[model samples]
Target: MLAVALAAQFMALLDAFIVNVAAPTIQSELHASGAGLQLVIAGYTITYAVLLITGARLGDRLGHRRVYLFGLAVFTVASLACGLARGTGELIAFRLLQGAGSAVLIPQVLSLIQRNFAGEARVKALGAYSAVLATGAAAGQVLGGVLVSADLLGTGWRPVFLVNVPVGVVLLALAFRVLPRDDAAALAAGRARGLDLPGLVLLGAAVSLFTVPLVLGQQEGWPLWSWLSLAAAVLFFTLFCAYESRLARRGGAPLIAPRLLRSPGMGLAVFRVAAVMAVNAGFLFVVTLHVQGGLGYSALRAGLTFAPSAVVFGAVGLTWRRWPQPLQRALIPGGFALAAVATAAVGLLLRDGGDGGLWLYAALVGVGAGLSLGFGPTLTRALATVRAEDAADASGLLATVTQLGQLTGVACFGALFLHRLESAGAPGAYSSSDALLVCAYALASVAALGAVSGLVRLRR
Candidate 1:
């Protein structure tokens, strides 16, 4: 069961960074524009983020193992679809399918762990999970490069997605044999409680309206419809909250309980998660582009460059549980500060055109990212007290926000830097110091925000 969960998590993490190394190749091969490439990556992320809550509920309604297997099967097929895709359009469609599978799979793993484990055992297990997660994320960038550069069977960048099939099949087989059956009586009783259909619709609509427009607007040049969608997003989300509160009053299931949202610590944790994810995702996206395009490094080199950070992050994650309470509180903010410093250094390095020990600076960025990302599991365990019944919902909401944060980081930060670059007459290609500097400052600001959030929690 653990193996299956790990495999699913690994696949998702792999997808996140692997695409970064493959982006240039994907663009050149498909004759894709910048927006097209962004979609290939962000489209999957967006869809994955939007459906996270719904997917978790599916696991709750049906058996978790059932949902897990279904997700793996769907993901495997989607991987093949992505591998075989001959155009940007086809690839994007396949990636969306793949994202859906991930949404289903991810919630179940945490849900299972939360359901099964308690006390010190749960904490230890979570620590291990977080370390693996951090390692997988770092490894993805490197592995993507290796596979792409190797051109295994002349598949080029396709092997990154293609490689999941064999692994998925193995997991599927193991899952069938090893996964425990759900308590049928419990499932039935739970099902008697109504699912929040209205809440689901409103939430989905809200996410789609908010995300699609911002992502597309930048590429499509901020049309009137984009503005309209943003407006609709605000309206829908407001309605969703109202409907959910009413449902709670009526003695029914709301997607996420309003009571949970009222927990100050949990609320702060959610915001912190969002901030960290945004910074992490945005940093990876920009840095990957900078290293490969700006610094003239090969795909393989670019991936390998992140290795040090992966190691540190993995190591830190393992020891995080042992840290004292004050230190644990400080880890997140400290990580953010480190990242900010690293980003600033990288910006300076780029300004100097990769001269004056830029590689050293790049390595620092990796260290900071690793340190920051390593604490995610511990933080999660801290928040919400790892309750059994609420596990799926909590994990799903966290995952959703995390993905959304990543998307937001890219959309908001990338858009800002790109705009600044354009206005400054910076070259359209990725090598400009102007863009790098802008991204650096943006990351720095995010770091400050993370630190502030962390401190607020500590004071309270």
Candidate 2:
């Protein structure tokens, strides 16, 4: 059951990053314009983030297992369509479909774990889940490089999407055999709330407005439309909150629980997750650009730079349970601090645009291990207080926020890095390495804030 769920999840997450290394190839082959290429990439994430809560509610309203299979089937078909697409428009449309399928399937993984596991076993499962989440992102880069470079069947970038076809087929089979249907008790709990369409629409609009701008603003050079969209996002979100509050007053279950954030440690823990995830995303973006675009590293070598972090993160995630209880608790904040130091070291060591050597590799390794310590425990604790009935809500909320955090980090830090480069011009102006140095320092600062937030949450 676990293998089936994780494999399905890894496939979806892999698609999120797998195109990065192949973007150039895709653009060339499809005769895609620059804006068209950006759309091909951002459309998936935009829809994925926007529709996540609705998807979570669907799992609750229907059934997790039912939703999982349906989503897998949709995702599988979409992957095939994406690979077969003959034009950039077709590819972009299919990519959006792929994201929607992922949104539908992913919430079930967490809901299943929370429902089925207990005690230390639950902790271990959560750790493994976290490992899959982190590792999937790193692996996509490496695998994308390999698939594009190999040009399997001379198909070039198509294999990245095509690869999901067989895996999804297998997962669909396993899901039927292993995934449990909703029990009477779970069904009763889930049915307590309707789909809440008005709330769903409001929240979806808010997220779409917020994320679309972030995804496109940097490329568009932060045009007036982006700022206006952001302002409208705030308006829509305010309306969403007010509507949700009204729904609660009317004895309706809100799309998001009105009181969920008020639960002890919940808000702070979510913030910590958001902060760390943002920094992690920004780190990946800045470093990728620095290595490949600035430092002139080959795609394969640049991808390999992230391998140490993925390995360490997986190792620490799987093994964290062996530590003493108190030590495990201490590690959350300690891990954040460690991540901050390592991130700062990376900034300093690579400031000159040279490979940071083995020390840089060690620092990258620390990045994953430290983040694992903080993220896995924080996730466990955040959901610890949630009711089983609200598991889908919590999972969807966290997943959506994590995705939003990545979007925000990439937009904000990516822009900052570019701005730095623009300021340091050819009249002895800044290089891409200088921009990277600045972004790395900023990422370290965010890591430090995550540590502080972790410690503060512990006291509560």
Which candidate tops lDDT? 2
Model 2 stretches astray by more than 4 angstroms: 427-430, 457-460
The digit string of per-residue lDDT tens for model 1 on 1-460 reads 7766877788876786687778878998999988889799777777777788898888888878899899889988999899999999999999999888888888888777777667777776676676665566568888998998999877778999989989888888998898888778647744765578889999999998888976677778788998999899999999998998888898989998766666446776777767766766676667676666667779898787777777676676667667787776567667766766776766776674563365764655555553454256435545436456677677777777767776787777777766766776756444456687788888878777776666664323
What is the TM-score (0 to 1) of candidate 1? Answer: 0.91
Estimate TM-scores for all models.
0.91, 0.97
In terms of lDDT, model 2 sits at 0.86
How many residue pairs collide in each prediction?
0, 4
Give the candidate number with the greatest TM-score: 2
lDDT of 2 by residue, 1-21 (tens): 888998899899888888888
